[model samples]
Target: MIKTWHLGDSRQSMVLASFDGRLPEVVYWGPALPDGESHQAIATASAADVSGGMVDRNAAVSLNPEASQTFPGHCGLSVRDKNGTPLAPAFRFQTETASEHCLTLVFADNALDLTLTFNLALEAKSSLFKLQSSLESADEIIVEWLAAPVLPVPAHADEMIEFSGRWCAEFLTRRVPFAPGARVRDNRTGRTDHAHFPGLIVCSQGTGNTSGEAYAFHYSWSGGHKMVAEELQDGRRHVQFGHASGSLPVGRTFRTAPLYATYSENGLNGAATRFQKHARNLVADGARSPRPVHYNCWEAVYFDHKLDELRSIASQAADLGAERFVLDDGWFGRRDDDTTSLGDWVIDLRKYPDGLTPLIEHVKSLGMEFGIWFEPEMINEDSDLYRSHPEWVLGPADQIRGRHQLVLDMSRQDVRSYLYEHIASVLKHHDVGYIKWDHNRVLPVVDASQTEGTYALIDRLRSDFPQVEIESCASGGGRIDFGILERTQRVWLSDSNDALERQRIQHDAALFLPACVTGSHVGPRKCHTSGRVLDIKLRSWTAAQRHMGFEMDPRELTEQEAATLRMVTGWWKANRDWMMQADILRLDSSDPAIIAEQQLAADGSRFVAFAAQMRPSDQVLPHPLRLTDLDPNAIYKITLINQDEAPALSRGAPLLKEHDLEVSGQYLMSHGLTLPWRFPETIWVLEGRRL
Candidate 1:
């Protein structure tokens, strides 16, 4: 028996399910119905011999030919029975419920009294589908492995791309040819570590940046996860992803994390655009009315806190057009450094004499919203909280700590309640507008059960304080996923704010996520992470491209630099609405040293492009940089912003002297203008408006 369902606005997506009297298998999933066809398209595709009848044992069986016979290539549900035997290829089709946008299919094994349900949902406006599964049983059963939405791809998808990275340097793309067998990317760290991101992109043999067919898969889970892309013996490829689970007794039910899959005929950028649209529509609180310009006090005064010094910094930030001022770490109890006082949520009287009231009031008076930082999920062994409740910490009794901190056993209700109350007390007592929530350490002991408790805490926080904004950070870029984004407003991209490094990080991170939800800040001239000094012009230009913010001390800036900061902030404030609402288009560049990105409004009225030179290329001469995603028929006036900072060229600087150049969008994209040669670490911004 088989069933086919049509999904999406244009009815272009088809999900084909076939049941061979045992379990239901998803045979084909992609694109929509062909012209003048209804269910025939799927019926014809699944008619092929999916069973292992024609597969020759001598050729099909690599090592053990009998292994492929009993356990077929595709199994909807993979489980072991009570007698330590794998379940046979048989299941009773129970029932199915369907709606315009969703379908729920159920199957059962009466002997084991176990039931499995697969839920599928299609986004109304795009070809993005979400898959999740749940298992329930009436009797006690030991479940070993469970995966949801095991989707099959065509055989032509021979190229694969996955991301891997370290702390300061993240999102390095790795492309390889998809050979036979399986390739798995696992994230066992309790939190999404900086090492490997949880996403995969598979393309056809000749796919390029903006052309060809591409498919992408990403998990919504922020905890330990595993993504497997396998090419079976029948020349079919499939992808399966879910939370990493261990054997456990299933008394009632277990649900797997949701996996999002999208396809694009227009290449990787087209697929990324679909994902960004889906995410923007599903944000918990919706997009912020107007994204705020933030000023963080971390790099300025790391562990040193003084009321007068903070007041001066806040005043300077407000003067530079910053809308929010955040007081970073070292403001909590006995927390002079990272070594102690992580769990203590109370204010440090020694640092602020009177509590946070003085600093908060002063910041509010300066016309900026006051924000504070907290690390509620971590605690130091020397802290008062850990000493009082030793059992609240995770791991062994004599466990090794990371960054001098132990993970709080969030799975324990008592631990969750204690941290919740303390964190809530701070929010309730103060007129705080934002919270920079930081998770500094990874879980040494992996516990899948703790994920639910972490979600509960965040859900409750959002429910209790609906007005407060939260920025999720796990040592930077660690806890970024749809699950966490549903509860938080923004995410910090990296701890290193060096402009040159950030260009690559933000460029790749924006592949799946939009720039509006990513937090990019300007650091000191001499970046603390890379120890590379960059000019303020380059740093400010790069930061202005995203949810703009400043992390350096305003007092350190000279008069000229301060004026530049003011100008950049003012420009962002004026154009942020369009910036946030535009679709990001990553232009194809032949030169590896140059990275180009564009933000074009949905209605094609305005566009902003940022071009940066990572290092000095061999070709010192200027070349034409063509733009993308513009209306070819419309005439646009291109103006080079912040060009006053450009050095005097031999021809008296064409970019600086030319206030504006009028050109047709067709000409600008095809026969583009040239950019002058500047020093390394130089960034240029071009703004185009349809006239």
Candidate 2:
């Protein structure tokens, strides 16, 4: 799709890109390819673009203009008209390499068909690259890159492009995914990088005071082009690039040749769809997200929960008007906590005389939604399934060793079929309205032979059973990826339930996914990540707008805490409309104690700003706080939740405090009433508005 040329000598190097209007493209950084005279002709067949077969290439073959010869910094590739014009930005965004790996663009198709030939003993290798051609296909994409596999000190001393890894030994979709894999080449002087994603990674070549240099390669797609950034992994470097907004899904496969990465035909669409990110359309007007602000029953009872205990919890939830009740770990067969009896989806009859049916009905009787948890992706070594077909567990496709914690071979067709049938039976048998889909481990080993099929069988399973809402949890944030989001409703923020940990965690997460990302708040005292106490205001504020829920036992709360929760419950029920669709703004974060505020609006007239106060101390300003989203001049009635409700105060009276935006330290900081004072305050309810 995008093509670039690299002209480098022992001294300096220049990389440039040229487009033929084959696709829409953009450039985030400059010094692109200058139009040049034709000097060479193709000896073989050539027709602009080839759609699939990218999986086979060790990496891209074309080069870009103006890129760091030492390290491929954040330069990009874009396609253009025959006149070689640059497309503008819309869906495309400039990527930044922060501490973590940055994935700019991802594209997938059912099949990829490309071929590479390495002479095995030659200095050079030739490959035919193909890409995003057909709009539809649900098969495998084939890629063949590598002169040969690296076998220690190559017996032949030849530069080769061997399959260091299978970008897709096996994959699913109508096409293949632009999977990330790298090939490091050491022809003479040192090692050169080859990656599956775009951007340059500055590897440690014994340079500077660095402890082995490494650059985070950023992958991004915009307006029909792909761009990347190379940032020093060492903490001493901080490159604050602008944030990417709107939508973008580009395809720029990273492969290895040597010197630098190059592209050919079918350049990435800055705002195109990815190989895996298909927006299976779960949102539309009035189509409320299936997520709920309900509590989890685990920490409340551990694995010792009985039917009666569950029913009691359900009763309290209903009293608080909670819409859902989830029955966590223990209920399945003999399984309890994380120890034994996992992989046993059957219910433990000893826990109840009447089985899950009665519990489901009872939860339903309380008029709340019912959901169950399952760790189907894995099994205990002692599981009957393991004993019956141990080969179904993940092991070396070609004799790789170590019997890991039993992982279901979702890559196998038989395993996929069997899992689907069994789970469907359980689901159809219950009156459950939701399923908490959890996969608690990492996948480093895979056996994806033709007989095994794609490990993405989970996606197909969700497609087949779309009736109930699915909340994904991988011991918290483990398996979180864009692919999984297409099939589920929400994901647990982390295994740690600490409110403080969540403040940072949730912020980092929302940088990518949408608001449906859910966070849980265990009650009053210590819980989750931090066994530390969280003030009610703090917990509520941090979790508001996201899916808010209570986890700790209710009766344990002091009368004051119970009263506070009751208020939250009522407020949540009445004002949920705003939380779902309103735009959000960050108010304050100078203090971790002040988690901050978010507001949503239906029209220009209906708006609500929600703020939660965590740690209240001398650090808090004594001055009035000004709200950011406030209308500069509109006067409206404000409700200071607690103050307005005090019996000593009159109704309709001004719990209303005047809020104004003033300059403080070269910034527009809001001046407003302080916390607990406005704990449940409805900042303002605009009758006739301006904001």
Candidate 3:
């Protein structure tokens, strides 16, 4: 059985676990504030009048998952404290388990300001209290920053904090290093657990505070609690506030996955305990090799199917030295397009004709791993599950509405059990080596009877499927949190797969998650997602900078382009292990408009710099780029290769040209890679042993 320790309480401050844990086990959720940093401690709740009748007695509410649930707002005089903190849409805060976890919220009338403040908080958290404006290691703990990204990652492990389009969190684990697919064992629990958040976001909405308790006034998407009024013996009338997030609460579902939110801090603690959990997540070796850059046929293939067709593609892929072939969407039950039969897991005969067995065999015959995609968290309005149980939607029966598709109530045990069974069954059926688990819609509501409080649904999934290589997606980047990462290995960086756009996305993505996270670039002219025609090698090399892949038809590329991709594919396959773990050093773009750079460092050595000298101009602009975290005077050899056909140049691209570039504290070189006519670029190398 999964074990948990009981916590102890104390006086004053109501013991936000003042004396919890006989010792300790996991990262404690206290507050998300960074140490030595400060924010307006919410204008101080102690001074507010907090006086009134248990206000609205005739109020009604409900927790149904399908209805249009709304936290009714009232127009009343704004209450101001002695310090004059204006209270509009105030809420009372009191949790049955307040000592266990605290919620920190960022509310700005302006959405952009909310994002800006969030970014500031992220910067503060990254230093983990250090007063500098750079990235590195620190220990003010944070399992998942609420305001960060939905799919969060542990990048530097201690200090750096990452956010992907403000939906996912990424942890920087380099300082301590850990294996990618391993579990983190806690001193508290002899049992180890996986730690990485990746998944779809089911729900998120606004709330208001009406009560005056320190937590008395607050708001969230919750029902079942009634707004009540009462008269005390003092002959004064008072009101009771009802809401979600405390006794009132905020409900979230992570595709029925395990999402542990273990810490929070207001920045005043001697040390944030969540950092300890991060420390625990640290492993003996770094995460690398667990993720591979294989081709996934989803946008590339969609619904149109024929095993022979894919087999033909696979033959070329295998010949190109591709490691795996992922068959995405339309393979399961009658699903042939954006709108069609969903929630049915059986393979369609009209398409595959003969079940997936032959296709699996065909892929296997070509000596490549096989994978599949599934939108398990959602069901179409015309889906089998929806038709069978319309009541499964999350809001009140009469008022319920979905973002588009109906999401399964993973919050329910039966639903959890069923989905779990179906997923595992599919995996075993094909002995599938990989799964690109996709959840296209955000959750509208969760009404599972067996679950309670916070993180109920996610916790349950972690308990159920302990082994699965799931990849999280939400339309594009909606739900990405640390909780999902505990189970899935990677996440789609963003749905914007344009090569040029990917540079920023990749840079921004790596800021928070590990370098192994995948970002695909497949399309014609630009990309289907972006509409820019890019050099395949530029796309491939940029992707090499990440867990890259192509999302285009094999037939579109010229034999030359195909050959070019095959060559990079060769390099990627050979350096898969090295690429995944090397500390990345994103360089200034060779082409100010192009996303380009290099990566280096392994086994405690000086880092190597890889730059994509992409210039829109005709000549190579010889600008010396600052190589990140490098040691000065470390004898290193720089290698450069031509982008076009380099058969003769392949013996080793660098010629005996006198290029003793001088660098200051770190070696800086002015020697530039000659940009070729065909245009994909290759530059940099380690002089000797692994850094």
Which predicted model would earn the best lDDT?
Answer: 1
TM-score: the better of candidates 1 and 3: 1
Q: How many residue pairs clash in each candidate?
A: 2, 76, 106
lDDT of each: 0.77, 0.41, 0.41
Return the TM-score for candidate 3, rounded to 2 decimals: 0.58
Q: Write the per-residue lDDT of candidate 3 for residues 79-149, one digit (tens) a residue.
A: 22224443232121111221232322222222111110111111122122100011011212111111121
True-structure lDDT of candidate 1: 0.77
Of the pair 1 and 2, which is ahead by lDDT?
1
Query: Residue 680 of model 3: what lDDT?
Result: 38
* Residue pairs with clashing backbones, model 1: 12-32, 22-91
lDDT per residue, candidate 1, 1-691, as tens digits? 5455555545246555543433445544556546565564555466555455554421221101112235444333455655567654234568889998898878776776777777888877655788888888775555555676677667788888888888877777878787777787767787767776778899987786667888888788878777777776667677777675452334457677788887777777888877776666655373466898989999999999988999999999889888899999999889988999989888888897778998999999988888889888899988999889988888787877799898998888999899889989999999998989899887877666777788899889889988898989889888888878878888888998999999998888877778688899989989999999998888898898889999998899999889888888899999998787677778766567888888888798989988898887677665677887678898998888856656665255565346788888889778786766666678878888999
Error of 1 at 348 (Å): 1.4
lDDT of 2 by residue, 101-144 (tens): 11122122112221211111111111111111111112222211
